[model samples]
Target: MQARVTGHVQGVGFRYATAQRARELGIVGYARNRDDGSVEVGMAGHDDDVANLIDWLQTGPSAARVDQVTSEEIAPQSWTDFQTG
Candidate 1:
């Protein structure tokens, strides 16, 4: 699934935390800080794993005070490894 998470998502190690979370879930994709103070993520995995990821986005890391998380299911992409970009 592709998630276009927004609000208080940058400058808080959100991208790094996302990378670790994605790895823990055995997901393959990329996450990056968008220009508009939001973070974007693309991930591919089992339904449950994806769900768990989506759920975590709500709380984020200790430094992130996530105001919202928007997610949409998209066709999977080919990524060698999850990363921050």
Candidate 2:
């Protein structure tokens, strides 16, 4: 699924942390900081791993102060591996 996570998500290493966790879980996708003070993530993996990621993101990196999370199921896309954009 593709998730567009918002709120206090940038400049806090959120993307890197997400990439590491996703990679460890054997998930494939990419994450990037948006111009709108949000983080956009594209992940393709088992439901459990993706759910875990969504939950973990509620309280993101030490520097992050996540205030909200919104997820949506979308057509899955293939990625070579997890990465940060």
Candidate 3:
């Protein structure tokens, strides 16, 4: 799944926290900061785990003031580990 998280999502450890959560859930993908101030996260894992991550994205880290999280199913990528960029 691919998710775009908006609102106060950058420069606040959002990507790092997301990578940590994804790792704990055995998810493999990446979390990157977009130029538009949103965070883009790509996750591939068990359906339940992916869903769990998406749910967490709604609130994100304590410093994040998440206003929206939009997601969509996508072709799974061959990622062996989760990363923050």
Best by lDDT: 3
Arrange candidates, best lDDT first. 3, 1, 2
Q: What's the CA error at residue 47 for candidate 1, in Å?
A: 0.8
Show model 3 residue runs off by greater than 4 Å.
none
Tens-place lDDT per residue, model 2, 1-85, is 8777777788889999999888888889999888889998889888899998888878878898888788888886768899898
Superposed Cα deviation of residue 84, candidate 3 (Å): 0.9
The candidate, 1 or 2, that scores higher on TM-score is: 1
Alpha carbon lDDT of residue 69, candidate 3? 98
lDDT of 3 by residue, 1-85 (tens): 9999999999999999999999999999999999999999999999999999999999999999999999998886899999888
Q: How many backbone clashes are present in model 3? A: 0
TM-scores of the models, in the given order?
A: 0.94, 0.92, 0.98
Q: For each candidate in the order shown, give its overall lDDT on alpha carbons.
A: 0.89, 0.86, 0.96
* Alpha carbon RMSD to native, model 2: 1.0
Error of 1 at 15 (Å): 0.5
- Residue 74, candidate 2: C-alpha displacement in angstroms: 1.2
lDDT for predicted candidate 3 compared with the true structure: 0.96
Model 1 misplaced stretches (Cα beyond 4 Å):
none
lDDT of model 3, residue 43 = 95
How many collisions per candidate? 0, 0, 0
Overlapping backbone residue pairs in candidate 1 total 0
